[model samples]
Target: MDLHGPLRDASDTILASRAIDGDLVAFEVIAHRHGPLMRVLAANLLGSELESDDVVQEAFISAWRHLGELNDPARIRSWLMRIVSNRALDRIRARRHHDDIDAADRASTGPSTEALVEHRMQLDAVWIALGRLPADQRRCWLLRETAGYSYAEIGETLDIPVSTVRGLLARARATLLLEMEAWR
Candidate 1:
């Protein structure tokens, strides 16, 4: 009679279990509970709220489809986050490989003289250097620096070990410092 009522108050474990049992209301509850945070994580990863919304929606659909495959129902939030991160990463990869000639030409247009202030130039250089970094390194750097995530948090979100996170961060820092030496 009131399928949604009990689901609203259920724990993630309970909801995940029910979702695995094909209860749409339970899955809906899970989506509603974690969607905002998932969107923020996607936005932080992808740098666009609109893209983040699509990534989050895609994640929910994926979760719904594979709820039965979840090994640990209690960790549903982290699982959902991992899905969102992977989806956002996929989008980034797609953007990198799409190769729109017009977009490339437009971006190649050099900045105006007045627009190349010292601060702007430095910022532009940083972005250019960041773009040069490998995708994993860039993701680690952005998660730690822009999102203010702890190394452990970044590792968890990216499904990598803490040691690997540290190593990637070190390499990213070294590369960025070298690339920005001129700005210093």
Candidate 2:
């Protein structure tokens, strides 16, 4: 279809409302807009970029089937992300064993050695800092920063108060900044 048309420029709420009404083109637009990010989330959770496509595909399928059930059309991006994470987790649980290879290494490509090394070190520091955070704080930070979730959305997803989400994110950010500064 003409993806360059006005539909592509529509807001997530508009697109999601259209999709709920069985508008295939609108649904396609939503998929196209969110697919790459969904796949990235899946790959990170699954630790296999190759399998991430299937996980995202399953998420889309599930999303299509349940679009009518979504309470807020504006939150469709987070909704799709939740679906992909669930699907990826399901796949991980289904696997008999796990591979030793890291998905991050596989996903990285074409950077110069120096650039790659520096980037990797920075990423490692962030991960180490993330690891040291309290579980709730880490989760809140990840949902807010990595998943791009709003505080209210993170609160809803975690069944916590919005104030709690804010506090967790604040503490997580402060700790992470301290850790990263130490690393630097």
Candidate 3:
């Protein structure tokens, strides 16, 4: 334990307690612990590492603003994850809204035939399969797989039921599996 470590309780309860008391260090500790996961969620959701930092920053800001309302400190990780996921979702939605018109005119860039890579080809195949899915199914699949969110957590984030989350993921998985079978 770094003697300077924020919050007396390395345990979340005391850490959250100290943070709620306006301890910047305590909150910083929380951010340090969870930042990578938040970034992964954002990066995967937005499909751009460039915007992930901003998304996570927004989540931390929201966390700072709302930490007091949290009922369980032990569950802080999940709470922070939810904020990050929601922030990422907001960014993705805004980006689509802004970029949709230009999208049709965009030309994709890829490695030339001479420079083709097997892993990149596989990734492209997966991306294409995912693109064919309905927007809701794709979003739910990404939320579950990328963020490691439980069905209930995904439901809460997307404002749907757990059963719906399961169905969406199921459909997404089946579609992708069928589409990627050629790669095997």
Which candidate should be chosen as best, given lDDT against the real structure?
1
Model with the higher TM-score, candidate 2 or 3: 3
Candidate 3 residue pairs in clash (backbone atoms < 3 Å): none
Candidate 2 lDDT (Cα, 0 to 1): 0.81
- Regions of model 1 farther than 4 Å from truth: 1-4, 101-142, 151-184
lDDT of 1: 0.83
TM-score for every candidate vs. truth?
0.64, 0.58, 0.59
**Total backbone collisions for each predicted model:** 0, 0, 0
Cα lDDT, all candidates: 0.83, 0.81, 0.77
Worst ten in a row by lDDT for model 2: 96-105
lDDT of 3 by residue, 1-184 (tens): 4546435448766777788889888888788777897797788778789999999999999999998898888778767877887788677656533433234334367444433445546766877787789977987887877667789868766667899989999999999999999999
Q: After superposition on all CA atoms, how large is the RMSD of candidate 2? A: 9.2
- Output the TM-score of candidate 2: 0.58
Give every collision pair in model 2: none
Worst 10 residues of 3 by lDDT: 96-105
lDDT of 2 by residue, 76-162 (tens): 887887788778756865662352234434655755556656766786677678768887887678767756778987887665799
